[model samples]
Structures are given as C-alpha cells and as structure tokens.
Target: MTLAKGCTLCYQGAKMVLFVTGRCRRSCWYCPLSSERKGKDVVFANERRIEAPEEAVSLAERMSALGTGITGGEPLLCIDRVNEYSKALKDHFGKEHHIHLYTAQAPTKPELEQLAGLVDEIRLHPPRECWDHITDTDYIASAKNAKEMGFDIGIEVPALPGLELLIPALPYLDFLNINELEWGETNAGEMRERGHELADGVHNAVSGARDWADELLNHGKVHWCASSFKDSVQLRERLKRIAENTARPFDEVTDDGTIVYGVLDLHPGTRDAVVARCRTFLTEDEFSDCGDRVETAWWLLEEYRDRIPGKKSVVERYPDGGMVVEVTPL
Candidate 1:
C-alpha cells in the first residue's frame, strides 16, 4: 500500500520528475514510454517540455518540490546533461533536495564519482534477459562501484517470471524495486508478443504481474509496486501535492487533486462590460481575469450565475500541470 522512500516522495508531490533524455542503448520490450517520448531525445519536467536545465528548476519551484528523480531512455548515455541538471537542482535547492537516477547502463567509476556529489541514490536496471542470472552481467560491478563511491545503490527491474535470480545479488544492494509489468501505447504489441495480457478490469497492467512480485517479498529488501498503486495512489497523491501549492485564489482544489473553477467566455465587445460587472458584484479575492475568460470559484459563480453574462462552465483540470479533465457547460 505504501511506496518506497523515493517513490513515496514522488507520490506526495515532493519529488519532481526530471526526464533528461529518451535515447537508450538497451531495447527493453516492456518499456511504457509514450510514442512521443520513446527512443526520442527529449527533456520533460513532469508533463512540461523544456529546452534548458533552468526550466526544470522553475517547474520544481512551482510545485514546491523537495526532491527530483532523474529518468530517461537511458540517463547514463547523456551523462553531461544528467550532471548539469542534478547539480543545478542541488545548487538551487541545497544538498538536502534528494535526487535519484534510473539507468540501464553499467556506468564506470568516473561517471559514478561525478554523480556522487549531487545524486543521493542510483537505481540500475539490468537487461531483462539477465533477470534469471543477474550475477552474470555487468550490473554487479556497476552496483558495487556505485556503492563504493557513496551512492545509495539499488536494482530496479520489471517483476517478470523467474526473477529469483536477482535475490542472490541483494546483499550488495541497499534496496530492490520490482515494478509490475505494464502495457502502453508504445509497448502493447511487444507485450502481447511476449505472452502478456491486460489484467481484467485493469487497463494497462499485465495480467499475473502482481503474482510474480509475491514470490520475492520474503527477502525484506524487495519493494513490490503494483500497477494499480502507481496509477491510483502515486499519481493522485502527486497531483494533490501540486494542487495544494499552485491553485489560484479563484480555483478550488478537489479531493482527487484536480482544480475546479468556473469560467465565463466573453465576447470581445462585451468583455469590458463583464469585467465592470464582475468588479462591481464580486470581491477582489473571488475572481481573476484569465485573458479571454473570467475565472472564479465554482460555488460562488453558481450562486450568482444569473447576474453574469455569456457562456459559462465549471471546469476541472489537472493540478499544477496537464490538461482539462472535465467541463460542465452552464
């Protein structure tokens, strides 16, 4: 029911997602990146696309972020970018701003050493083919290297069948994260080809994925993240956290982390009259002029709808970022 430390911060909206790049050396069949991101060299801070490192910092400030998780198609491939952003966050927020990284690459000592001063944790994803015998891969050396260089080292992999091989290597790791296999727009075909199917009533999770995680929980170091938990708990909590920090005076934060507000679309000629009317009838704290529309609390607008002109709606949108979730036309 609860997430790991890094993931828990993420769920609480304290951890910002810093996607440095989408170029990876390994081709994991179950990667859930969307078509716009997979195999492409793009940078995103949560849902906002960005061109510079400072944009991520600005976005983090907007959400009152306490930490960041550096992810990518393969972050190590873009080591310089990782170094830049990681150092930037720590510089701006101070060292207590927890930062972690996810990579499939078995980085060298120099690369890890560069990250040690900025990154607090390093999670390695060895190829799925090596899941049955993790000790045989370069991940062992990389994990030990990360540990020695003062990073909280751990292994993160899909909770696929025959993952018991990773158990033997747990002694050298600080923690182990097993993610439930998932199907997405970009990886659906590959998932089906590998004999995975959606769990009944669950939209994207691979069937029987949770069962694979059960066999490993006795190890104490293992953290099993069910697909449902990621979709429902983690995402919602993050949204709520952002909503609390970023909601405008006229916006109402919902229990689910969405913001609910009333919008009145005004004609170019009638905008002046509407503004005058709003100013006369509503208190300064109750309304805001949002370019082409007037925004106010849903309940306040509903209480005085008869006095307001033009097409009106109660809109619910994702908190802090993302798009509109619902609009009730009035």
Candidate 2:
C-alpha cells in the first residue's frame, strides 16, 4: 500500500516533528502524550524546546528535513502558532517542503481556509466514539472541505476494537492510518484500570492492537504503524539523520545513532594542566575545553587514561547535546 506523503517522509527519517502546543480540550483515554507535555503549554521542534518559529526552522535545517509533521495536544487549539510555524518552515525550505498536521478537532471552513496554502495534508482524529457515526459528525464535512481546498485529507487513530466502525468513512479520506496503541506515563494508570497490557515486555504496544486492525491490512489506503517500529526504527533513523548532520570530528556516531566521545571532568587545580596536556597530544579539532570538562575522541582518552589528571569517562549521548544514554567510567 502507498503511504501518505507525510508518512513517506517519516519512514525515510526526513520529517521533523513540530510540536506546537500541549493544551487540549479533550481527554481521550488512550492519549499517549507524556506528563511533561500532556497539559502544559509548550513548543518543541524534535526534542528541543523553542520560543520562536526561527528556532524550529533552524532545527529542521540541522536534520535536513524534507517535511514536517505538526502535532500536539491538539494543534488546532493554537491556530496562530500553527500558522506561524508552518509558514516559517515553508518559507525557509521552499514550497516543495511538505507539511502535514494532526488535529483531534474537526476544523471549521474558516480554520481550513486559514491553513490552505500553509499545510499540504490534514489528518483528522474524530475520537473513537464518533468513528461508527463519523458521517453524523463534522469530520466528514471537514475532510471534504479540506480536500476541496487542495489538502490531502485522511483519518488517523490508535488501533482500537471499534476500528471496523470507521469503514463507512473511508471513502471521504485519502488514506487511513492505524497506529499501534501503546501505554504512556500519563495514561498508564487508566490503561491498567481498563485491563490493557503491553503486547510484549520489550515494547510499549498494547496487546491485540494489530489484531484489531488486521482485517483492514489488505485495503489499499490503510497503513499500519507498529509501536515497535516507531520506538526503534523511526526514532533510530531520525537520530541517525541528526547525528550525521551534527557530530563533531572527535565524536563517533554509533550504529544506534548515539554519539560517543571522551570526557574529562576537570578538578579545580588540574583543569589548566589537563587542558594543556590535551592540547599537546591532541590537535585543535580533536579536543575541546568545555569549561569544567575536556572532551576528545574516546579512543584517545582510552590510550592516555593515565596521562590525564582528572576524572575520565566515555559518554554516549544523543546528537546536538541531547540526553545522555550511557557513561562508562575510565
């Protein structure tokens, strides 16, 4: 089956996740947003929080994004921000830079009109309750109207038991994405109370999620996104893209997409001596004196472990100074 334009970019690790805001009006039982963003008002381009559209543009450029997927608690809730960032990305990246947006709310004609040229695709989320009676809701009109205005329209929802109920609404959509439902920090208690469990111990996917939507796999427009694929493949590919664009000369980009480098935690008296020693043995590009610590290639530190007079270790972390993944003491 052909993937939607946005999904195609995402599968290639060429799509940036532009999180506009975390404020939403509805509380769906399966909402997997993390506690840090579930109800908070914040914006993030990938993992970096930002205060301006320019920041999002910069982040997108770093990873050479071919497209962007604007998402949030409900992006429509902050229409102004959505429009601003979408315009900024398109403006900087050119008209060919595709953009797709996800909104739980059924946008009115005015809202759809506002997003006309800025967004190329719209994925509607009609809430599970409205799936069986989608024709009776505003989503049908929204999808039809969006299509008329040049937007590729589709419906995306977490895989749930009543998925078949959405069959009647498929004709109004360009595609239907069935995302593997998974547990989240904010929804774990609720999921447990509802008797939901992980499909396996290693993945966050809900049990029976794929089986619920298995019958629709043969449909040409149906795309199934497994939770494990999102957690591993998607995330790893995205990280690899970022690491390719941002890794330092001394950093070793690992197969898993994390960068590994040597670090020397400087002591008050040994800071200068350590910096001086690093300069003598390492070229200017090979070592960096980052205030309280000195950084170099992990192999260099491993060879000169006895020569440096400070706490030494090798760290593997996400690119662009993201979260630390591992630290091995030397």
Candidate 3:
C-alpha cells in the first residue's frame, strides 16, 4: 500500500515530531500522551524541550529531517504557534519540506486560511462517537474546505469499531489512516473499564483492533499502522538518524540508535590528578570533562582502566546527551 507523504517520511525516520503544546481540548479515552506532557503547556522537538519555535529548525536539521508532523493537545487550538513554527521550518528547509498537522477540531475557513500556505497536509481526528454521523458533522465540510484550499486532507483514527461508518465521508478525503489501538499509561484504566485486553502479553496493542480494519484494507486510500511497527521500526529508524548526526568519534552507535561510551566517575578530591593523568594519554578530543565525570572511548578507557583513578563504567544512552539506557561497572 502507498503511504502518505508524512507516513513515508515517518517510516524512513525522516519526519521530526513537533509537539507545540500539551493543552488539548478533548480528552479522548485513548490519548497516549505521557503524564509529563498531558496537560502541561510545553513544547518539544522530538525529545528536547525548547522555548521558541525556531528551535525546531535546528533539531530537525540534527535528524536531517525531510518533513515534520505537528501534533499536540490540539494544534488548531493554537494557530499562531503553528504558523510561526511552520513558517520557520519552511523558510529554512524550503517549501518541499513536507509538513502535516493533526487536529481533533474541524477547521472552518478562518483556521484553514491561517494554515493555507504553511501546512501541506491536515489529518482530522473526529471523535469516535461522531464517526457514524461524520457526514452530518463539520468534519466533512472541513475536509472539503481543506481540499479546496490546496491542502491534502485525510482522517486519522485509532483502529476501533464503527470505523466502517466513515465510508460516506471517504469521497472527500485524500486518505484514511487506521492506527492500531493500544494501551496507554493515562488511559489504561479506561481501557480496562471498556473490557479491552492486550492482543499479546508483550505489546500494548489491543486485542481485535486490526480486525476492525479487515474490510477497509482493500481500499487503496486506506493505511494501517501496527503498534509494533511504530515501536520497533519507526522509532528505531528515527533514533538511528539522530545517532548518526549526533554521535561523537568516541561514541559507539548501536543498531538500536543508542550510543555507547566509557564514563569515569570523578571524586572532588582526586579530580585534578585523574584528569591530568588522563590528559597525558587521551587526546583533547578523545574525552569530555563533564563537571562530575569524564567520558571517553570505551576501548580507550578499558586499556587504561588500571591507570585511571576513579570508578569507571561503560554506559549506553540516547543520543544528544539524552537519558541513559544502561551502565555496566568497568
């Protein structure tokens, strides 16, 4: 099946996720937003928190992004923020940098007008209760309006029952994306309340979710995103891209996109002598002297383990000084 441009970029790990705000208007039972960002008014470029819209440009460049996906509590709720960031990206990356936005609210002429030149695509997420009567809601008109306004319009919804009811609205859409329904920390209780169980013991995918899309698969415009695929393929690809761009000469990039390096835990009393000793053997670029620790090539640290004076370990972590994944005492 042909993927949407945004989906294509995502599968290739070329799309940077730009989270503008965490303040969503609707509280969907299946919202997977983390607790740290669920209702907080925060902005994130992938995993890095930033204060300005322009910061997204640098982060996108770090991952060598070809496109970006704007998502939030609801992006339409803050049109100006959307406009600013989209404009910054387009200005820096040019018009060919594909941008798609996700919104639960249907856009009228005004909202579509604001997004007209900046956004390349718009994905509507009409609430499940309205799926059966989507034609009667503003969503259909929004889709039609969005299409006429030169934006590729589509509907994106979790793979759930009653999706077939959206058939009547299909003629107005460029595509339909059905995401595998999955358990989320915030909605796990609600999911259990609805009597849903994991499709398997391992992944968060809900049982029978894909069955809901069995008939829709035949349609050329329809696409199904499995939870496992998102977690394993899409995320791994994105991480690899980041690792390639951010990894230093001393850092070992793994297939999973994490970086491995040796760390020297320093004590206040012996920090200077240890650093002096390290400087004799390690080149200026071979190690980074963090306030409390020193990081260098894992093999270099291994070879000089007996010579250095502090606790030492091999550490694997996310790129760009991100969270540590593992630490083994050396």
lDDT of each: 0.85, 0.92, 0.92
User: What's the residue-level lDDT of 208 in candidate 3?
Assistant: 94
Candidate 1: segments with Cα more than 4 A from true spot: 1-4
Tell me how far candidate 1 lies from the true structure as C-alpha RMSD in angstroms.
1.8
| Residue 49, candidate 3: C-alpha displacement in angstroms | 1.5
Please give, for residues 160-205, the per-residue lDDT of candidate 2 as tens digits: 9989888888899999999999998989999999899988999899
The C-alpha TM-scores of every prediction are: 0.95, 0.98, 0.97
Q: Point out the worst 10-residue segment of candidate 1 by lDDT.
A: 1-10
On lDDT, the stronger of 1 and 3 is 3
List where candidate 2 sits over 4 angstroms from the true fold: none
lDDT of 1 by residue, 29-61 (tens): 788999889889999998889999899999888
> Root-mean-square deviation of each candidate, in angstroms?
1.8, 0.8, 1.2
Candidate 3 clashing pairs, residues 3+ apart or interchain = 24-73
Local accuracy of candidate 3 as per-residue lDDT tens digits, 1-330: 667889999999999999988998798999989898899888999988998877899999989999999999888878899999999999999999999999999999999999988999999999999987889999999998998889999999999898899888888899999999989899999999999999997789999999999988888899999999988888889989999999998999999888999999999999998999999999988999997999999999999999998899999998988889999999
List the candidate numbers ranked by lDDT, top first: 3, 2, 1
